[model samples]
Structure formats: C-alpha cells, structure tokens
Target: MANELTEYQQNLVSLVQSHELGDIIKPLIKEIHLFDSYISGTSHLKDRSVLEKIAVGDMLSLQREDNKFDSNAILILNEDGKKLGYVPEKDNIIFARLLDAGKLLKAKISSITQKGSFIQVGVGIYLVDL
Candidate 1:
C-alpha cells in the first residue's frame, strides 16, 4: 500500500467527521514537541518523506482532556462518562483480543436498572456490542 493507516489510525480516520477532516485529525494525531505526528502510511519506519508533516497544525477546536497512562493503555468511557473498556499498547484493535481473549474488554453497567450503557473500546476501535 502506497499509504495505509494502521488499525488504530484507520479507526481514528473512521472516528473523524469526514465533513471536517482538519478539525478531526489536528487533535488526536498525536503530538511531539511542536510537530504533530500522524500515521502517514502503515510503514513503521520513522522517515519524514512518507510521514505527513504538521510542525504547527491547527489544534483541536475543542479541548480534549489529556490523560496520560504510564502503561500507554487507556480506558475509554461510555457516552455517560463511565468506564467502558481499555485500549492496549501499540493501538492494536482486534476482535479476537476484545472478544475471545476474555480480556477486561467489556465494562458492565454499574446498576441493572440504570439507563446508561456499556462502551466497547480497544485502542482506536469502538464497537457498540452492548
């Protein structure tokens, strides 16, 4: 592939509002110093040519809360702002890992009678199984 997005990158692109690409990618593309890093292509080499450049790109119009997890994994909450599930390191989003591995892949609703719902998260993948 001349340029391919990783599963996580793909999920990110998927999450992006196609109507507004700049608004979506500018925020979560991952930043380092002033230059923001995006998965230009799926090639893992750290080269600038194939890499998309944004030394000073537009920041997120909406401020996204920065939560740093030392483990590099993070739990994504549901719509109600409740813990739903986690995304592993390297941003691997596989159905097998989320479903077959018996991982802490799914978060349960705290109360049976609650109107809230569970969110499914695996890296960039957000599957609404519940």
Candidate 2:
C-alpha cells in the first residue's frame, strides 16, 4: 500500500501539527502528560527527558542550537508560564539565544525560591530574580 493519507487525515495532521489551542485543548507543548510526540516524516519522537514530565498546563519553551536540534540556554516557565530560568543542558550556554523564536526547553520546576523565583529545570538551579 502507498503511504498516503486522506484529505481528512491531512487536515487532522495539520491541526495537530499546528497545535492551535482550542477552547477545550492546548497546543502540543512539552508539558503534555504524554511525551510520545513525533516529528513528521521521521522516527524522532520527543525525548522522554525528566523535563517532559512536568504537570499538564505548564508552559514551556525550548532552547535550540542554531535554531535547530537541542543545544542549551533553554528556559522554563512557571505554572503560570512565566520565564523562570534556563536549562543550560549540562554546561553554561553563552550564545545562540532566541526566545519565542528558536528556544525549546524540556525541563520542570525541581525546586522553588523567592527573590523572584527560580527552578531546577532542564539542566539545573536556574535562578531568576523578580
């Protein structure tokens, strides 16, 4: 059989691909309970990192490398989806900074602090002063 999809299937794919949040659902963000998301035309499923386990409804952003594959400097937001801190991967990321553009984070709040509020997410102690 040919690898094909009907127009309806295509439209469904588009809807899922675009991840447009509707009144009853949300976009496919990392916080979704399921981390089995897959990229089109590839077997690259979203990595089931410890980060992907964040509670549902939590807002998250990713940090990319050259606006592509995983890199560093990725940040995570609070439950309210506010910029709380960066991922850092495993080390300090000095460049390739892009928010709401190329950043894609996969972490969660490991701990909390005051001042403003920080998190032990993606990489680790990303503190953000209020």
Candidate 3:
C-alpha cells in the first residue's frame, strides 16, 4: 500500500523523519478515508453543551462499544473524553472490523450544524498508519 499513499502523506512521512525525535515519534499517516458522515444520535447525549463547544477540525476518538445493542457499534468521543455520539451503524461495520484488528484509525470533526434544539456533528474517519 506504500505506492497508494498520496503526496500529502508522503510529505508528512518525510517531515516526521526529519524531526529531532523522529526516531521515536510515530507520525500519523492518513492512509485512507474510511467514512464521512454525521455522528448519529447526538441528540441523545446528556450533555449537549459539549456539542456547542466543539468545532470543525477538532480531533476525535473512536472506541468499539461491543456491549451495545448493535454489535458493530463504535463510540465517538471528544478530546476531553466526553461522549459525543457514535459512528453511524451503517458506516461502522468495516471500521469496527479494522479497530478490532488492532489497526489505527482516527476521526476529526468536518462540520457542525445547529438544528433548533440539537446539534449535528459531521466527522471524517481515516485509516491511520503509525
């Protein structure tokens, strides 16, 4: 898959290797765009205030929620460890599989919209090579 890396990823790899702590630092290589969609069920979060504070470009974390009703459920959380919502079930099958396989993956807020009494969070999921 080395040949498949975009120019951006190549430059990132080079930049990381050139740093003083390059030997130990694991730079994230955005390998692929795994999914792009709104985080589902944000309206259900107890703390809606967190949604208003988050902005686009903020880094988010994903965790597999195996005990959830949906076996493929994945939880989306903010940098502060607050539960934001979830990776939509329809788009989480492959992501869950990748996470279960010990592959590195990450999400970043792509957009945020205020809808009446609730907030909608859009995220871009990417496969990362450390």
Among the numbered candidates, top TM-score falls to: 3
lDDT for model 3 comes to 0.77
Note the residue pairs that clash in candidate 1: 87-123
Best first by lDDT, ranked:
3, 2, 1
Per-candidate TM-scores read: 0.21, 0.27, 0.76
What is candidate 3's lDDT per residue for 39-124, written digit by digit as tens?
A: 99998988878887788999887888865589989899888989899998788888877777666667999998878877788899
Q: List the residue pairs that clash in candidate 3.
A: none
Candidate 3 residue-wise lDDT at 71: 92
Top-down TM-score ranking: 3, 2, 1
Relative to the unseen true structure, what is the C-alpha lDDT of residue 42 in candidate 2, on a scale of 0 to 100? 13
* Lowest summed lDDT window (length 10), candidate 1: 55-64
TM-score of 1: 0.21
